[model samples]
Target chain A: MIARLLKKNHSTEYEELLEQIAQGQPLPTDELEDETRPMAQAANWLAQRRAALDPRPGYVRASRQRLVARLQARGGKRPWLHRHWGDIAWWQHPLAHLALVMLLVASAFLSASRLAVASRAWLPGDLLYPLKPMAEQAALLASLTKEGDAQLHIEFAHRRLIEAQSLVFENRYEQLPAAVADFDRHVSQAVILVNQMAGDQQDEARSLATELQQALSGQMGMLMLLTNLTPDASQAEFQRLLMISEDGVSDLRNVLTPDGGDAQHQGWKVTPRVSMHWLGEG
Target chain B: MPDRQHADETRLVQQAQKGDVEAFGQLYEFYAPLVFRFLFSHLDDRLDAEDLTEDVFMRVWEALPGFRARGVPFGGYLFRVARNALYDHYRRNRRRSSDAELNLEWEDNFHPDPAESVPMNIEHGELRASLAKLREDYRTVLTLRFLVGLSTEEIAVAMRRSAGAVRVLQHRALLSLRQELERQESEENDRQTFKEEPLNGV
Candidate 1:
């Protein structure tokens, strides 16, 4: 009740006084009735205080110079790389420069890896064919253990078979010879590496060799069909590829079975469905 | 202010962002007094205010690179920095003393224009003493509004309050200040009466 009475009594008078002060108007003595005189006097006192409180000129000048000098000093201490790498003195810190170079090299290798992945579908005569094998070689180099090497070689041989088929379909006869050579090289490398394995790895190597032989037999059948359909000029090349694949299959079976007994009993022979159609006529 | 002057200040801020020390120095010159006034009013100590003013600008220099203007006036942003610096000063110095006296050294330096002088009997020492007794928010709003000449909207921006809230605070500050002055006067009158009664007893 008392607070409400005070607000009702003083709100208008106080508002007018504050407005006058805010507007930089002269406080009115004529309008000051006895009850409002204290407020008027307070407003005038505040105005006088504001006018009297100008910042000393010398202090302002010193603070500005000090702040500017401090800023310039801070700017000067920033590393050259943070400021700009164009400075020749960036090499002054050898480790930092080396780190920068390593970063750039890492970025370039990452980009190349992406490009190589994108080039996976490219055929022998395509612009990105070189990158395909380079990528394969990189994968092979990354895994140089005996089993890993054998597995990668088989993978590359499978890739070569696919490329040879693609070349035959595209009538890219000139590149088929190179593709066949690559296929034979990978299959031979996979068999030789598998044979060199010791005790526990021998069974794993035999299983991988069997899988490789089966893939080769399938490729050989495809080559036989392609040879039959190809014109006379390219028929010999496809026939050669078929022979190379058949020889690869025979070599894998010999490596797996090692005896002259029935290779089918040892489960090293190509399936009947794969070899029967091509071999029966031959 | 004229739009051209505002444009010039904006340009200066942009240059400061790009590590232009001269541009930043220009900003320092223009804002140092206002900042010093704010610190002086808040700290009420000349040396601490001066040191804290320097601290505020040094912070500004370090933080300028990341400071995006958006639509806030540079003055409002600067006062915000000043406010935070004062808060830090208080937090650091709060346990030491509660001396709330304003430095009146500037009174000696004040040279009012001859024509503008209206001689009044208001005792400035008692007025300052009353102002010092006010709540911190009340004193701050009064200083930002009257001493620093910020508009209510600008005070709202600097203080992070609504403009209506700032107006209410300003009114209350004025009322509280007047009431304090009245209290002081009544106490003085009582002291005078006590002294006269003792003389009568004698």
Candidate 2:
């Protein structure tokens, strides 16, 4: 009952107690009926707050000498490469962040370029990468980590396109279209996988990434598939559709005829030539 | 003036507010131990208390020149700034911590034995954990009255309130502290193999 009374009248009772303490009187026995111990708690609170605001005696002096030279320069505009010097009370210059950020970007670029030119990097994972045709495509893999899955797929597709070029030079149309078809299918599959994963989390940025991944994957897939599977000409008839030479002779003549028959002369490899259809300008 | 120290303290505040670093440093040295004791009681970690003490002076140095030379005692203005800074620091750090992390952060380091020298080394952090649990009124009153050694009149000026109001806050703050202490004691009893330990080692 007294506890409830104290709760109801606690604020007034608090004042009465402080007055009593200040006057050097023990809390009245009636007021002490419910709460006699709130005294030290308030004492502690004030003390703690005070301590946090005041540390060692001369810390201000210590920081003054440290900040004096930097303070002089910041009176106008600060130098870009100088220390951040984070004091808003003195310098409210808006250009501070802009200069700092630009310097950061430029220095980062220079450091990356210098390291790229001067550094010799060896990775333990390089030994495992040569086993896959897709893996053989990424020249940048040995140097960095941020290329992500989409870049990896693009690198692989471009590599397969290079391989198709070799087949075109060799007149290997049958194998060339099949390789293009494989690249198309994988890229399309990767696209559908991303599309299936959209709208999952609250992070719109990540969701947008899924959308981009799906769209690019589909575009890449269609490019490969359309070039290989379009029905304008029969698989063998494509041999006469050679854009490499305007004579429109069969690819075998170029490979077998003595005038141009030297397969090793133009760095050409011997293969069937079904790779004539290219959806892209490449 | 040489004898009373109180009159001298007022003079120092006027000089400190005029950008005298030495005057501010004198106030810091005089009040640092008193502040630490209060922080040590409220927070359980000695290091955090020490850090906040340092931070308080750092902020005082920055804000002192702008501080108005109002007729109220300088200690009240100084501690009021310090108190507000503590709350701001808590608010900022709260955003960076998860629920579990906050619980861990707020864990009290006060032991059953007052003589336990280990935790008092970093008294401020430990006290903050306990202080965070208090109601705002209780926190303000308690901090102003006991910790900062503000008279009721001084607290009145800083809080923009009547001395009666500050006294009431002091009372309510103490009640809350008692309740908090009791609740913690019971909770500690329920935990298995729980032993009293100070968070800050001597």
Which segments of model 2 are wrong by more than 4 Å?
A: A1-282, B1-7, B34-52, B95-100, B103-116, B119-129, B188-202
What would the TM-scores of all predictions be? 0.47, 0.39
Number of the predicted model whose TM-score against the real structure is largest: 1
Interface RMSD of each: 22.0, 18.4
Error of 2 at B59 (Å): 3.7
DockQ of candidate 1 compared with the true complex:
0.13
TM-scores of the candidates, chain A only: 0.53, 0.24
Q: Give Cα distance to truth, residue B189, candidate 2, Å.
A: 4.5
Candidate 1's displacement at residue B167, Å, is: 0.9
- Candidate 1 residue lDDT tens string, B42-137: 554456778888888777766665556666667776777788777656545654323443443323223344343322112333334666788666
Each prediction's total of clashing residue pairs, residues at least 3 apart in sequence or on different chains, is: 0, 43
Give a tens-digit lDDT track for model 1, residues A130-155: 55665566567579598899899987
lDDT of 2 by residue, B42-115 (tens): 44344566666666766665655455555666666666666655544453444433122434344434344455
